[model samples]
Target: MTIYEPTQEALRGELLQRLAKLSAPSSAKGSVPHGVDSGVNVFGYCVNARERFARSRLPHPAVVVVLSGTKEVWRGDVAQRFPRGVPFAIPAGLEIDLVNIPDPQSGRYESICITVDAPLRQSLRASLNGLPDGPSIPGSFGIALSADLVEAYGHAASALAAPEAATAEAVARHRIVEILLLLSGTHVGRMFVAVDRAEQLEAIVYADPSYAWRVEEVAGMLGMGASTLRRHLKQAGTSFRQVCLSARMATAGSLLSAPGYSVTQAAQAAGYASRSHFARQVRAAHGVAPGRLRSVA
Candidate 1:
């Protein structure tokens, strides 16, 4: 089946109307969550209302479409804007600060985010192996959406709205696969299929933060020279030491929030020999003490 490209203005209008109709009262003062909980890989998101600026992380690689309003994302020293009717891809494990602006006339901010986790990436890689060889695709933290991508997103949104559980799941999966196929047809799509070295390294460190991970050892595990690995990470706007620290801090935060997990346990798991050090890192990352994380988590 082919995807249909609708006019950008028309698409934006439709999304705004749908978001206004589905708007619900949220306990959090300036937030409204509108999305389908399909219990599958592909999920939808529509924020009817939100703070002017918010800090958040995707936790996984995702393609986010802005239906209405605008989203400004700042990663490291770079910032990009995804305006209405545009979509962008984000790499995994990056902490981002976001600014969401509503339309001046309508006062609504609506969007949809499709997350592609490890399992989905593996599936895409396997599927691409069967296709004929394509041109090399360079990796980037994000990519602008094409007309094909916009059409595919519209189809996925409609499919996810289906009432039947089985039908919705099947349709959602199909649309995702279709999008991947379309991407694979492009040079950039080839890059998306290949596992990003930075993402892989981050995952490894996150899995076992307690291990003393020397830069040389981590590079050896990836089968690359230490200097080469460092250069690769530098090109990605991060360093090995930063990745390890971020992973450890993220793990510590999760542990502190989990039930029955003590601060000591979190500290140890995050490779912190002292509770004070763990607390300091937690405060730096979250602007709150470790005890506060437990209360909120």
Candidate 2:
């Protein structure tokens, strides 16, 4: 439950023997081995020990992100020392290994683990700057996840606590995607949707086509540095101008396609000060004149 100081030492004592018993990379004897899911689904909520225990190496990619605990966990040589509120991402390739190093001698440990495939792992790697044009934080063979890691751990814990079978499988996967966005600070919803500036990037451009917006709006909203957000967007193959134009046109097109909404009305609806300007944007976005697009609608 909590991997405090004395607890970690105690866990190591029994770890090897218990692992020996499981044969296929086992965990501490009493801890549940919640079955694997081929990475297509997430296998989660694995508690290895209460006071102390042993575990075996995991067969596939997995990360035992510490939600609340003190311990050392790793795959192969890259050992990570972490505490409560840290979600360390262990790239899912190395040999499974863990050691108990609880805090203030508490001797107890607990964590929320997520299992995803290598491609997702690459995405995480490219997106780690946690913002557009931010520094590129490379994924490691055994590196601990970013300081931003703590955020996603909360979501994983909640989901693992109450998995729903009735929901479509896509719902579950999307939830993981949500967690990844939060962890990376890419999706503005992770923080305050209304208050975070990053949400502005997520803002409906069509809502106000002529409205002047700056990159700072999105960067500020998400509490991320502007440079980082820019770099990330570039790496992800998008520029700020591109996203903004798309947002505006999408909003205007929706308005244009509606009954009783003329081209002028649609332009104003999309926040354009002049219908002519709105028309030009529509042409740029769809590669056709506004009237032409309107004719089709």
Candidate 3:
């Protein structure tokens, strides 16, 4: 079920038609429609022009379908590109620079991002019958979105648009579970096990990057002693400071990607009082000045 370039083009056409109908006119660019709740949530974004989000962090694993345009993700030295109709999966707690390129003729770039929550990941893993977890890939990787996967997305989208919010949640989860089950047979399926501790810490810090996080406090939340937490992080070759900074910068990058976000606001959102200091950190992390990374329109 490998999706070739031609097949992807045709698939994208059908996906766009389904998503366009499901898409409600959003006042905010890249805003999550239907809200993010529980462990599973679905949202669609349509961009009329080109956009880039630097150091954006995905706290949960995501499966994205590029509807009309293309998505380019930079993970360290590698660049993984997903053109229209190509679906990709990103591991939890991944920080990457993302670009959205609109179609030349249609002048639009749209995608549907579905995040798999912890509970769903566990359920999906258990269904594998004790299969060992797959190696964690460095960044987002493209996967063959077979006919069944596409059908799952269509069902999820429809469920998201259900009149009752509760109904939408229930039906969408069922559909998303089906999608994951189908994905388990792919190369990326093995990476779908429970997220690691470092990833968990990063997600927590990302949820509120502004908070001054101490190792002791965070360890308490994770239900472990400070020493054990430190040992775990030490084995992973990272420290609390590094994790906090990564989460903060990722948060700052995301803020800069939003419309009307100022460098100072982004800095403050990430808990930096000094603009100069924040600029230095942003440059160190993303290799770009905060002002340069600001989103236009």
* Candidate 1 lDDT over residue span 118-170, tens digit each: 66677777887743232221123334445566566557666666545667657
Error of 2 at 19 (Å): 26
Comparison by lDDT, 1 against 2, better one: 1
lDDT of 2: 0.46
Task: Give Cα distance to truth, residue 296, candidate 1, Å.
Answer: 59
TM-scores for candidates 1 onward, in order: 0.51, 0.35, 0.59
Candidate 2, superposed: residue stretches over 4 Å from native: 1-59, 73-79, 95-97, 102-106, 118-156, 168-170, 181-297
Candidate number of the best TM-score: 3
Clash count, predicted structure 2: 38
Distance (Å) between predicted and true CA of 169, model 3? 2.9
Please name the candidate that would achieve the greatest lDDT relative to the true structure.
3
Candidate 2 lDDT by residue in tens digits, 1-297: 975443333433333222222222224322443333333345323344444233343333444444335656553344556655333443221223566443444444444455555455445545553323211121122223332233333333344444455543444455566565554442111111211222235332322344565676545533467788787668767877776666567666665655667787767655677777777888877788877777787
Candidate 1 weakest ten by summed lDDT: 132-141
- Screening candidate 1 with a backbone cut-off below 3 angstroms (N, C-alpha, C), the clashing residue pairs are none
Q: On a 0 to 1 TM-score scale, where does candidate 3 land against the true structure?
A: 0.59
How accurate locally is residue 96 in candidate 2, as Cα lDDT from 0 to 100? Answer: 38
lDDT of each: 0.62, 0.46, 0.71
